[model samples]
Target chain A: MIQQLNDSTSEAIQQLNDSTKMFNLYLKLGFEHLLDLAAYDHLLFVIALTVVYQLAEWKKLLILVTAFTIGHSITLALAVLDVIQFPATIIEWLIPITILLTAAYNLWTLSATDGDSATQKTDLNIKYFAALFFGLIHGMGFSNFLKSALMPGEEQQIVWQLLAFNLGIEMGQLVIVGMVVLINFLVLNFLKVNKQNWIKIVNTLVMVFCIWIIGGLLE
Target chain B: MIFFLQILSLWLAHDIHLTKAQVDVNTSEQSVQVSMHIFLDDLEKVIQEETGFTEKMHLGTEKEVPEGDSLLAVYLRSHFLITANEEPLSFSFVGKENSQDLLAVWCYFEFPLSDISTKKLTLTNNVLMELYNDQQNIITLVGPNKKRDYLLFQVDEATASFSY
Candidate 1:
């Protein structure tokens, strides 16, 4: 009886250790996936999202990003579980298209008059929805990476992995959003760049980069 | 300057540097089987740099160099190590196949053991570590009775142990 008890105890301990390691592994992968400079498509999207808002609007920005996090986590879970299917190539093509649309929207807002309160409200609402929808597309892109890491016959542990990976992505997203806000603050306050000019410059750059990426995809 | 160029080129070439290895312990067979999935581009670059072969390896294609297999085997022999009960177990390279997506290739190997039912196993996997600072190798071990364990190895810590 004592031997059986000891065996169960050790087995429980081993299971706990295994879970902790799995959590850390996926978390790190998800974090690094977003932060990877080599693939800056996601980074560019986050920056494009942030540049439209001033430093004071970080709270609102955070809410929008959280919505994105929630949005992606849903599809990431669904896609990996085989509840949904999309071609990997098409998903890759769509990722940059999202960035291009966000940048183009920024340009459109810039062209509009700055002080229309009703337009601002409508724009904010549209942006929230856009961020969430874009996240679903991005989540599919993430599933490709996560699927590559998965082992066959280990579907049971995916819940823990998905949770950890989504959290890691959120954490990485925050770092990027924070840095852009900081840079925007510094450029506006210290360098004395006009707010409209800042938005135009950054959005234009993002648009140009996306065009290049799209061109490469076409080639 | 050289280091900066290397880092820049690696960044420009690929988005992620990661590999997955599945190690299966077969008690009845008294052997361990390993299947590793690695990016084709990364493997080719590493082999070329290590072996001083400048030509493209063209792995998984009809034009694949005949020397590709031997070069890859040499790299694995040095970078991936497995031991049971502190006794080194040598593995034979069986073969490789390209993933359906063609983004990566799966390499197969086997380590024959006298008896693997109750032995402590340690693995040292440093594949592609010398090239990418953020290179990660994820190993999943399937033991007897379908018991499973997952391990993550990076440049700083690249060895993991298991017992069954």
Candidate 2:
């Protein structure tokens, strides 16, 4: 009992001392979310969204990407702030499905625009809107992670830590975009690869990735 | 550029995670052994909050609490309670072992009467509830050979009743 008394005394002191470790920890977690190859769901979603757009459409791409960012960020904040309870097992299953749906929609949009420049504008608009909703689901998926990392952190501090984490996720995402753009430039511009062939190859790979993830999750 | 990226990631996947408690009732021994596994870092954080301890409390580095107390034991005693057949069963701290892989540890506690012969047990586990709103505690009860039961405890729900 005497030993127990001392332990609690010290711990109470530590709580009064606020530290920056939590901030740095959350920031790193945000970056890990995007880059962890062990779980490529987030990476695949970003790739599928950006594969069709050229660097020339930078403004449009920025708008679409920002929409996704805002959508997920809101849910992540809600999860951390409100502590909204939900079943994580169900959320885990939905994440892979989200990737599958996003990839399928990409393939559908590609076929819709087949050799037609006129319909491209309409297709792009729908994609932008879809990105926002997809962001919400992705945000919930992200929330499962935030939930695990939320404890022992001050409720108020989490707000700032979450922002840091979101910023890290976005940074990791930008790196992925650079890689995608680089590959696109190399394959289409230098290798003289056909645009159709490139589209088919990348989309097919992502589709297979989706199936692989789904298969693993089911097991 | 990608090298810089790789350095940023893979630093450590030492993520904040859940806890697991295994309860085994040895009919012959007349006692139940509860082995609770929790992340060392997280446990320390929660401990720091409840107590005013500012020292770096790592595993195997046991020191008297500033007020001369056993931090782990005291914390566990308050949040983890067990009642058998609707009667409360007290837990006595036994020992703990830490795995070198980050801050995960297996903490041992005991209930003197676990000769669970057709009896019921209800456990209230709020181990990390105050620190983490989504703290998850998994409890598994194992018998001599073939019987196994499990209970999941979340923040909102902290009690699980078991009969076997």
Candidate 3:
């Protein structure tokens, strides 16, 4: 007769090592997904999301990024597990549309007074949830690669991998957002470019890119 | 966004072109580490079918499946057989890992030894064969001298002998 193979002691000891491996593998996958040239749609979307925020407002940026992470993880888990299957076609189209909308929002709100602390507070509340909401659609866009790369495992294990991968994506997005903020600081603070003009220039470029994507998708 | 990739995985998995498993031997440690990776959905179906267990076993959660681990171990032992110097060797269950990249769960197993005076072994891996007619299990055996031998096991012929 075969003895009990999995000892509790061994299981306890191996948990840390096993979890570390899990984090490294999924984290790498998540980071690479955002950086992939094929997933330029994703890269551009994240850029559009963060283009308006400056690095000095690190606290607000962190919250906004977290909200986006939460939103994507929900749909990513739902879609990949086959619990909520929407036609991937619709998602593909909507991803570009979403980017267009976000860039347009920046243009529409460009003149909103950032100097007023009260207005800034209210604006943040809106943008925080906005990132969360749009992030759901981006999650769908992210699902295919995620589905292909993930190895289906136990239910608990799948959840952990999903979280780990999402964390990885967030890390990549943070890096991109960081660079954007840093560049804006240098251009506005050091280079002495007009803050308003700088914001307009960046958002205009983002808007143009979004329209190009939408045009291609429609064709 | 392209549909071809999704369909491709399905056909390939069914055609025995993509599902994979691996193992590596450590001669100095007098041991071997085994990892078998299988799709979660596919694995769940097979486990449910073979054991006739009604409840689904969640990978990392506390969802209880009484005897799930034991049943899993039995199935693993039966499908994955190891021999040293023509003598049967039992495996000690290590642990398991789930990879989102592979959409598969990897269960770990190992065998301990005192020393490696000789390195000749046999391995039999037939995991997921019943469900996947095209399943392939790849075994890589390493010796103390850093030498390596490989075997690609297929349906109906799932065992290989290696000399290091």
Q: Is candidate 1 or candidate 2 better by lDDT?
A: 1
lDDT of 1 by residue, B66-128 (tens): 988888888888889998888889878999998875667999988887765666789999999
Model 2 stretches with alpha carbons more than 4 Å out: A1-21, A114-118, B1-164
Candidate 3 lDDT score at position A64: 82
- Give all candidates' CA lDDT scores: 0.84, 0.72, 0.69
- lDDT at A188 for candidate 3? 88
Docking class of 2: incorrect
Model 2 Cα lDDT, one tens digit per residue, A113-146: 6757768878878788878888877787777666
Candidate 3's residue-wise lDDT over A181-215, tens digit each?
Answer: 88888998899999778868887887787777766
* Residue B152 CA displacement from its true place in model 1, Å: 3.3
Better by lDDT, candidate 3 or 1:
1
